[model samples]
Target: MVPLRNQLLLGHAAEALPEVRDSELGDDTYVLDRLEQGRIAWLAGQDAGSKQAFAAADSRLAWEDEQAQYRLSRGLAQAGSLLTNDQTMAYRVPDYERTMLHHYLALNYLQRGDAEGALVEVRRANQVQEQALKTRADEVRAAKAQQEEGGDEQMRQQVSRGMPELDRLIGQVKNGFQNAYTFYFSGVLYEASGDLNDAWVDYQRGYQIAPDNLSLQVALLRLARLRGSPDELRETEKKLGRKAPPLVPSIAKNQGQLVVLFEDGLIPARREFFLPLPIATSGGDFRTFTVAVPYYDNRASDSGPLAVSVGNRHEQTSALVRLEALAAKDLQERLPGMLTRQALRLLSKEQLRRSAAKEGGDVGNILVGIFNTLSERADTRSWLTLPAQASSWQGSLPAGDIRLTLGAGSAMRELPLTIHAGQTTLVWVQRLGNRLTTRVMPL
Candidate 1:
């Protein structure tokens, strides 16, 4: 099961959409089916279909029956009645991936020249982001409160002793679970659709979260100019250290605007790491045990930028988001709960083994201990098909042909694109190493 899951994940990471689409495994696996359909639909430029499919899946998960099933499955897994393997674990919808779905749907609507629909998707994306943030915060708070109320000083000390190691592990990674890229795109869409007020709000929100993002800074400056706020515009210019460019004309007005989105590589995969925990027994002695925990490996893709040419001008794509960082932060945020659960599980197993030793001598104790050890597998399930990173390049040009050159020297390839007046063109490029898949959606 682990190998199969890794294969599917690596396949998507390598942009093997065709192979995933033709697989028979998805017929029985719900997550696999959804992921495969998403890749196929997006790659085929069937945005409407992809949007509907993801929406339907989200609705289904929200249904009462599905909710009950999920709860039961999770309970059984935690109680040690079910295996900790991928198939038995309850599915978790990756928050970042869900947010990206809305972001992509907005692009889809824009491609169809439906500005209102695009706005709706942008609003939905923001809502999802806010909801995810609040939900995670509430869960963490509740967990901490429960621990404080139930645990004694010794237990608290034991937990605290592990903090330094955990902190060190987390410190190696950067960024958080928030999606500044989504906020940035939402701001851009809002501006394009003439909602300058909302555009300013999103731009400011994004900038607050990722202050180093120059593109978002440029967005705020453009909004300031549109709103005729000279003071704010000047403030933005000083911060930017240069004069800002003129606001991009509305793409819906027959102006040619090209937006290239590149989804490069695959997000970091979750792997298990075992940590030795010391549990204090009633005898005033400590029992040394091991618990398995999950962490993200810092493996990233090294795909070069796509050099885009709009007539005589040339620009390379710039990083829009580091998704692996978000993934790492998400795991880091959940570490507290993970540690608590593992500690409880280990304590329970130790109690059981001790009881068996008192009742049935050394032979029974050995058997029970072996059983506990065999059943103590770590939960390694995650949404594994998300992109490693996302990048974008946007420019306004005369209605004509545009050229995109990917790679360099002997491996260089040219992709020609055509744009019409008052049109916004979306060019999606997925790269896995040297392999590239490009699609164009002209709106």
Candidate 2:
């Protein structure tokens, strides 16, 4: 009967239970099958022959000792038959199967209208299940880190940015070759996890490994633009073409101080705007182009005005302003917004809320600032900040659990965070006056 139950659980038929015709079947075999069959029968609300079958099966599995004691406890709770634990003293159930049985018992109790019994069983089963889930997650994480660090590039191919299916396949393959695909996938995974630099590293590695891949080419182009690097533009153009993707033109007075560089210069606008200007790159050496700080926004009927400042690289020089009205689908101008949305979704809800609060003045400005900082500092260390409570901003986190080597003159700090169930972590960076504070919070 025990074997029959196992077969049914495995989706095999009960009649397929192995035959032992000469001897009387033991309670282990009968009760196990009866328990399972009874549950199914109960669900269908059919008692007809199942009751007789189960009673006969239960007779063989009657409690005798330790096993009996366990069954008596379970049966009392399940049947509501008024039978106490001391009455059944002779059956045993394995611990692994125990919780599963308890769940079924709880369900049965629910069916019988014994809410208290059902609640007790549900709580116990939930505790057991929670522990099991935690164990599985820990095991999975350990396996992945092991594969990532010790396994070869082949292992990389098997790993699908945390996809279980890919991980299983990778585990089966030859364990050691690192290839362009592996790094490409790694980049995808890292990017999904809000680790842009890590993603960039993987993309860079993939590009270095296979410079001709068009996808890599696209990635390089995007990365360059985000960094506000004219040089990157030139380098990308060498492989691709000279035609520049359309971007918003800078409308700032002090284009020099705005760290973000574009052909037209730095944009200083605090609001969402659009510039239909084209971006040009040579694919040769990356060059530096300066744009004004306050950028022009053509999204509205009136093209926003430009404000040039005095302290630019071409300081005291007359500012060269390009007033261009952009179409709705300019790739450069359009892409940043799309990417920002994608990035935001990858963040935890808490992180998203903080970003929203800080950007209450102008979200576009904040988005531009983040995109430029991350892109430009691709080779350097970069961080992001979220809004703390009123009047303050959250501190920077190191992106992942990785320990970073501080760049020259970089300040370091430690943050403690709690990892919660079903939630990921988000860290924000802030620089107030000369003091840098990184506030770590849960999402």
Candidate 3:
């Protein structure tokens, strides 16, 4: 029941925010509560309050070192067997979803002016990305090895037949696990901490992946000048078609700057899809069967980037990352494992039916078959509370009071901001329809 409620909240986070805020659930009692409370606190501009909630949620979602060792041992123990006979498998959290939590915590730290803490979170997020990629590669290798050893030609053929459509969908994803937004934010933190060398490296990696991103290009140019790299600065300038702006002098002097990060809409949710294939049985008979699969539904959210006005100056936040793309890529990377597990499950059920027919009457076999078919279900779990997309904009503003407006006219909401020179301020905005939640964090 808690899982179902969590799914609902994740699928409709904007709609569910009000109810979650009204609930009496303690922050540490349940994972769902922690997730919801953290999001609510962040949206309400309570950066300090969200720390504990996010920390609790992170600890729960994390894969401990011992857990990985246990999983490895279990895999080795079950190796070379046709089927492990294990009916239930534990839920595996998606890597992108887990990385988002770390990314958000890093933002929370940045809002609180903890550069060192933010760097730690960024490093964790990067480690998660690396692990996810390695795990997927290993899964693909294992699936191929299993297919060769088991001589599951029919299963391999079925997977190949389904590849066309699946590959087409996978190809639509622009990026995978490495998030440009995380890289950009990390570069910002490094720059703020006066680590120009590390900042340049981060900016270079980010720009390599997202060359169209002006913010990254500018950052690279700034670092190039500071590090006395004329060639790199020239390359970046040529890519941008103009000279980049200088680093904020006040920020350099340790006064302060303002950074606005916006989480536009809800990320796409996972939905179940079915694919029917013909399976060859031991009796040389072919049976048409259906298997449940999961895919991303992109039409869930259509919210665009926000137009922000700080005092009288206006700038629109640029798209930094698309969670939908990353989610799709993650699914694609895990496709081999998904196909293998589904095929194995179907084969096990078929064997059960065959055995039941030999041991009992036709009525008993039919009952067993019915139960197996009814119990067949696809794994549809995901971190549903993630935003559809995230965008950011940063600028230098004098230390003083200012009015910030998101959107325009009746659709707009005005919030006050106070900036201090030589420091950093983070303004987070989440928009759902005409409703807006803004938080101002001074660092």
The prediction achieving the highest lDDT against the true structure is 3
lDDT of model 1, residue 262: 71
Backbone collision count in every prediction? 3, 59, 12
- Which 10-residue window of candidate 1 scores lowest in summed lDDT? 19-28
Candidate 2, residues 172-264, lDDT tens digits: the string is 211111234334433433443455576567668656645555445555565566557798678767766644454443421111111100011
Which 10-residue window of candidate 2 scores lowest in summed lDDT? 378-387
Ten contiguous residues with the weakest lDDT in model 3: 78-87
lDDT string, candidate 3, 33-61, tens digits = 56656765665566766788889767766
* Number of the candidate with higher TM-score, 2 or 3: 3
TM-score of each: 0.78, 0.19, 0.81
lDDT of 2 at 78: 28
In candidate 1, position 282 carries an lDDT of 65
Best by TM-score: 3
